[model samples]
Target: MSIISLDSVCKSFGALKVADAITFEVREGEALGIIGPNGAGKSTLFNLITGNIAADSGTVHFLGEDVTRQSAMQRCLNGIGRSFQIPQPFGKMTVFENLLVAGSFGQGKSERAVEQAAADILDRTGLIGRANTVADSLSLLERKRLELARALATAPRLLLLDEIAGGLTEGECSQLVGTIKDIHATGTTIIWIEHVLHALTSVVERLLVLDFGKVIAVGEPAGIMARPQVREIYLGIEV
Candidate 1:
């Protein structure tokens, strides 16, 4: 069953077209990876789905309901939790406190009602050790983990991760990938936009490639990456 569907969704900023009639479906409990060069409108596609950007044309359906017109806050309350490409934590808040805020506000629950789940998310994301540390003081890897943890704290049925593994060292990226695999193992649907090809292919069941705001190809990871046009456009390689 599809947990989310986008049909003919189009978006633009003045004269610049960001998403050109983009359409796709993400299955329930499936992990999907999105890949493209910079300015392919990858993040814009995400914004549209999460209601951060409204489509100029077409529809967005979540869990079989039309949510094209829903606001970002409404989408979050409906279980669409996302992490930004840049970590956006409250600098003064401790790691655990960050999760608590996300859980309570994003899920519309009280702090006490979400505490246990928040703690579990910390443990799962490998942030338990840094739970007491202030968000601004965390290392890059820890900040990345906290970002993931905060999203998980909202109890997302569908999680949208934006470049979560982008700046990590090899070992740190591996650690985050392991946590993501664990999340996927528990049947949380994921749509990850990433530049880390190996890390992405490690977790996602399928891959989608975009260029110039259009989906050039999408299929099994190996097949998608092997496509000549995809290689040329996304990797800057000649066939």
Candidate 2:
């Protein structure tokens, strides 16, 4: 079943069209990878779906309900959780506090429930040791994990991840892949936009390639990656 669907969605900024009649469906419990070169409007697409920006036309459906006009917070509360490409934890807050806020606000849980959720998220994201540490003092990888953990604290049915593997070492990326796989195992639907192809491919069974706000390819990961157009345009390799 499709948990999220975009139909003929269009968005523009001034004269530049960021998304053009975009359409796709993300199945419940599916992990999808999105890849494109810079300026491909990948993040714009994420914003559109999550209601950070409204579409100029078309409709977005979440869980069989039309949500094209929903606010970002409404969509978030309705089960859309996302992590930005940049980790933006509250600098003065502790890692546990960060998750506490997300869980409390994002899920609208009780204080006790939020605290329990935050603790579990810390463990899952491998941030248990840093739970009491201030967010600003954490290393880059820890920040990324916290970003992911905060999103998980929302208890979303559909998680949108934007470039979470951007600045990790090879080993660190591998570890993140493992963490993501574990999350997927819990039946959370995921749509991840990433430049680190190996890490993205490790967790997503299907792939979508976008360029100039339009989908250029969609298929199984290996087949999509092997396509000449995808290789040339996004992968920067001749096939």
Candidate 3:
């Protein structure tokens, strides 16, 4: 069954339409990748799905229930967890403290449970060594890992990642891809929006292309990449 569904979702900012009758469904445990040009509204689409913004029309459904009007926190507690492209950890908080907050508030876990979950999440995200380090003191890659870790601390059924691999070296991107692959192995459905094609292709089985805020193509990654329209729009190639 589809864990999340967007039916004819539409949104606009003044006269600029960011989403125009956008519709798609993500099956349980499926890994779907979204790719588009800079202004194609990929992040806006994530915001719509995660309740960061309400759609102007249509419905956003999770587990077959409509949550179009739900707040972002409510959606998080309802099993939607997401990581932004820019890591937004509490600067003064330790890495572990950051996860502790996410577990407690995002997942509504008890203090003890939150502590244990934070520890496990740190270990899983390769941030165990930096547990006591302040979030602001971490390196770029560590910060990115912490961002992903905090999201996992919520124990979400569906994960939304917005360009998590952005601004990373090739080696760093490879390591992050390995971590994401492990996360997917454990049955968490993931929808990732990334411009780093290699990192995205490494993790997602299906790919969706967006152009001018509309879904232009959806299919197996290889097939989607082969399309003339996708190549022209996303890869800057004429075919």
Candidate 4:
């Protein structure tokens, strides 16, 4: 079953088309990875799906309903949650406080109503020890974990992660991937965009390649990476 579907979705900024009649589907409980060069419109795709940017044309359907016209918060409360490429936690809030805000507002519930769930998310994302610390003081890796935790707090059925592993050390990336794998184990559908090939490939069942705002390939990771065009365009290596 497809959790989300983009049917010929299109978006543009003035003369530049960021998403050009791009179509794809993410299956329920599946992990999909997206890769491309710096200007491939990877994050723009995320914005389209999350309703952060309205498409110029086409439709976005989530779990069988057309959500293209829905607001980002509306889509979020309807089981679509995401993390930005840059971690955007509330600087003055405590680590746990950040989750509470995400959980309460995201779920449209009272903060007290989501307390336990927020605490559980902290533990799962490996932030239990730092729960009381202020968000502004967290290390890069810790902030990334908090970002993931904030998304999880929304209790999304489909999670969109954008370059969450970009700045981490190898060991840090592995540890974060471990937590992400555990999240996937629980059957949450995920579409992740990452520049870290090894970490991205480790968790995603399939890969989607984009170029200049268009989908160029979508297949098993190994097969997609082995394509001559993908190699030359994405890896800058001619096979």
What's the lDDT for all of these models?
Answer: 0.91, 0.92, 0.92, 0.93
Give the worst 10-residue stretch by lDDT in candidate 1: 230-239
Query: Per-residue lDDT of 27-118 in model 3, one digit per residue for the tens?
Result: 99999999999999999999999999989999999999999999999999999999988788899999999999989988787868789878
Residue-level lDDT of model 4, residues 1-239, one tens digit each, is 89999999999899998899899999999999999999899999999999999999999999999999999989999999999888888999999999999999999999889999999999988899999999999998788888899999999999999999988888888988998999999999999999899999999999999999999999999999999999989998442
Please count the clashing residue pairs in each candidate, in the order shown: 0, 0, 0, 0
Write one digit per residue (lDDT tens) for candidate 1, span 122-190.
887878888899999998767777878998988899999999998788998898899899999989999
Off by over 4 Å in 1: 237-239
| Best by the lDDT measure | 4
* Candidate 4 error regions (>4 Å): 237-239
> Residue 104, candidate 4: how far off, in angstroms?
1.4
Candidate 1 clashes: the total is 0
TM-score of each: 0.95, 0.96, 0.96, 0.96
| Candidate 3 worst ten-residue window by lDDT | 230-239
- Candidate 3: misplaced stretches above 4 Å? 237-239
Ranking by lDDT: 4, 2, 3, 1
Cα RMSD, each candidate: 1.6, 1.4, 1.6, 1.6
Winner of 1 and 3 under TM-score: 3
